[model samples]
Target: MRWWWQPRKQHGRIGRQVTALVVTTAVLLAGTWVGASRIPTRWFGPAHPASAQAALPVDRVVWAWAGAVTTTSATVVAEAVRPARRARLVLTADQAGVARSTAAVPVGGDGIVRLRATGLRPDTAYRYVVEVDAIADHARGDGRFRTMPSGPASFTVAVGSCARTGSSGAVFDAIRAVEPLLYVSAGDLHYGNPARDDVTVFGDLYRQTLTSPAQAALYRSVPVAYVWDDHDYGPNDADAAAPTRPAARAAYSAYVPHYPQPEPGGAVYQAFTIGRVRFVLTDNRSERTGTSLLGARQLAWLQRELVTAARGHAVVVWVNPDPWIAAPAGGADDWGGYPQERRVLADTIAAARIDNLVMISGDAHMVALDDGSHSGYSGAGYPGFPVLQAGALDRPGSVKGGPYSHGTFPGGGQFGTITITDSATSRVGVELTGRTWRSTILVSYRTTFPAPSTPPKPGTG
Candidate 1:
């Protein structure tokens, strides 16, 4: 009987076909069983390897360009050993764990981690840590940063924008050579899109830009704050109506978690006081819709903040991703898009008699210094507040030239730095720093008062 069961040669062609069919069915069954059982185990097993640690020494430290005090945020591109594993971010005031706190989410593309530590004491030293996995492998490390002084203090703040991968890091080295107290990235941190599909690319680009040894060392030591222009947000000169808005928002949500920012949907805009100066940070990208320069609610909030600052001896600094005082209109990406609204803001400031107001912006990719003369406000129609437009750190050259030009320095690779000294004299001095491959330079400084000595009070003026 066993010999008969193994005897396949005795059968004809039909018998051979039947045998082949049986063999094929058996092979299929075996494959199905193995695949079903093995796949689940591999996916659910606890024995899998852990993810790798994120690359150390994150880059792009942007201090609050548009906020109250000198509050700031920093961003880093890190990776996990396993694709499914998540990275851990932490901020601390001291190494003793007494002042440790997690930072708020930042605003940018995905795969980027941000750690923001706020309510920091001015001019004080604080230690921080950026950990990968606290609960699992417990991977950890530390870094250090110092806050701006609460009173008259002399400290350098390195400011720039428009940096891309593959470029010489000499500019960053130049900025770090100054050993600035804080680092500010005005906007356009990266050129890659902030959409979902481009997140990995964005991360890669950011990683490449930060890989420089000089940039890493400075970031490890200094606190960074940032805002986003169109490129970093997605698309060149992108607006609120871009098709990738949702994807951009998701990326922004993911990237912002590594930084300290206010709650989402609740105005990323905020204000903080550092020394005698008040910094006002704005979210010109998120929650900004319509054809107007600023939505009604944000405008109202800005007016309120400005009014409050006018009553005190603090220097109120306003930062936006786009330049408001720069020339020839037609570009919906800036304040020029909404002339009515800009007029409203200018008139309000004039009516409130608010002094000590300074406006700084990026996104023009050129170093421009304007005093609001080209902003379309007549000398008699608006307050003569000094508005400064610092060119971009990446492309420090002008694109379109016109009659409203201030000083266009293209390919100059420049940024602006301001130094404030609060003394009994009640006058604030601001210095603008510009840099190039040749040397780091201090371009200019202007001194002004919160309230003019001979000016009438608000209600009586």
Candidate 2:
């Protein structure tokens, strides 16, 4: 809200020339620069010292996750030490005061509170404070999130996977620093013993992983979309036979704020649209079989969603937990193990000619990138889209890209960032940055999406 210009103490000819060059450069890329200027003020907050009251019982209000955010509605998932009697959410356009309040939201006995706040303005920035049972403001959890624009817009998203429970890593802090509009965990949010089917164990794992100061801060600030894989799915390469499958799905419903599952009581496969991009977050572990990765029903839904989105949106992003490329060391955990299903998906996309499609994958332990040449596509030489694999926030070990891998980020512990810039000219620019937990760039990919023709006006066709 405050702006100031500093006067140069002394500017010689050389200084004046440099300043002129800077201004000229800014003018040259003014269209791209326009997107940066629209970023919300104070979208990200600085780290603050915990107040004394924060350490008291009121501190039971631990972390909050924003989910299923559309233009006018958002779901907030808050965690407490004990089942909260009364939970409230105060929303404000500015961080200072409340514009509206959703008071007395019901909290379940599981210490998980889900609150939906509606009637928000589209593409607007809001800061929320969650208070449990008349807790003081200083002790409440506060963070900021922006509703997706109903019209053309530009935004950034950060993603990673395979984070172990009770762990901290630089990747968490780095993700927060990037200040994305949204964050997603492709799968394996926590590694709990897959053999256990107890709801308490799954709940405890989420608490231990998300309540960590660094990870909590990131989730609190940016809205998140979630999809689960093997570990979080209840075992190593768990499938339909996993004993805890039902409990796993139930716990996810109790905690994460996600779009409706493709099927009523099936794996957490859902699709959502934000601006000109549509995202398909798949559940690859559950209902898994030698015949298909998502089973028949979910696969049908995915095909329908992709075809629909391709006709309407400028870009489509598919979130696959397992790598689309051949498995490393002939491992059965990735798409290589489900060759039939992988081919079906690849062929479907190619046949439909879905333009501007980008696939993001997790659960691979190391960051890797590949063009569609190795994406299991058949009936043609290769598909044109790119696949980005990122994760292993706390694990150790790295592998190089094989015959199918184009850019392999060696070493362990990394995250992925996708930045999209929408221009007035109807062109969208995308940049993917793969970085280590320490913020070192390992590989980068860039592409552009030309504007699709607008749909026919209503009652005209």
Candidate 3:
């Protein structure tokens, strides 16, 4: 099962089948010309064992990505290969600081071990190693993650999604080259869409993805903020009703080093901050119902978070893993499918005067940016915000979400980046660029945002 690509008529050309093996050898092969991007082979090809991590030994640790990063604290999640007696995380600041280790949290029945390192400096770079007594293959145990800045700062965030399940394409390498402060996996991190029966399926799939030398290296290099779309949560176009919902949520909580999930054992929605910007990540799949994209309670929380974030931060970034702008015949799988909800959100933003908002959405399989032109779906064009659509990491490309201000480029091996610079001036700098597997810029847009007129709210949020 690959990403949520439908029939040719439903998503023309998106059904172009390319098995993982076929992709690994050709289109995804390192140092090979990616047929989609039509670019030269510049990326460091597949890392060690790019095609075969499925047989990973049980003794080997599988920690996908370092996440839930904050100024003074961070979370590191590790999955033991099997029965383990001990698990811990050793952390050391990159700038020559005393080494520290977190006390081992009990490994869950699913072999999940979570560790949180605290008292770290803001925006500081640090190296960490996952120590698991049950795992013998811990050669790649060491990785790095940077803490978010506490105040105004300049940083870049790379966003990508819609890959060929566990593709180790050059796109991941390209994203790493930029050395982003964080990587926002917008969704479709994998297309397994495994049956709803077992939670271990997700664990193994994550192991495959995290062990893939390429993707693993990228995650180790950068902290990640991820939200799942249909393909990852369940089958194509899966919703809250999916039987796999429980298993998916369980796997996510146990395996992912994500921000503190607001609903804990429920929906996987979360919010985080970087410098003066606040990022709101919505669980587009878990809480989604037939009538609402983000169920009622989640929707209400999102509205409050948005208004609060907008008031406190200089900028608010909505990390929605579904297409916000509607496409022609963009039926149910996207925000286009829930017009009323869109109106509610738009109205909420307008009523609260949340003008410093910019949205980064995914599951489009294409790179498109709307410069606050056609993204407004509210009554009388009340609330408008710039939107950047990115992804199809290594899957068959298909355009959804519509006529972009900078036009759309559809194909695999794609990603997007957002760089925010806070200067002494009153306006903050926000730049969005869509790049390809070869790091080729397809479209770039820059917009200056006003610094918050009000004082920083800090914990008032």
For 37-80, candidate 2 gives per-residue lDDT tens digits of 22211112111111111122347576678988877888888786
Q: Encode model 3's per-residue lDDT on 154-252: one tens digit a residue.
A: 999999988665566677888899999999999989888876756888888887788766687788788888889988889999988998998999888
Question: On a 0 to 100 scale, what is the lDDT of residue 179 in model 3?
Answer: 97
Q: List runs of model 1 lying over 4 Å from the truth.
A: 1-122, 131-142, 166-168, 194-206, 212-214, 257-267, 287-290, 371-380, 399-406, 440-442, 450-461
**Per-model TM values vs. the true structure:** 0.67, 0.82, 0.86
Candidate with the larger TM-score of 1 and 3: 3
- lDDT, model 1: 0.50
lDDT of each: 0.50, 0.70, 0.76
TM-score of 1: 0.67
Tens-place lDDT per residue, model 1, 97-172, is 5654564343333334444455555455666544444422222234566655645544566667675532333455
How far does residue 347 in candidate 1 sit from its true spot (Å)? Answer: 0.9
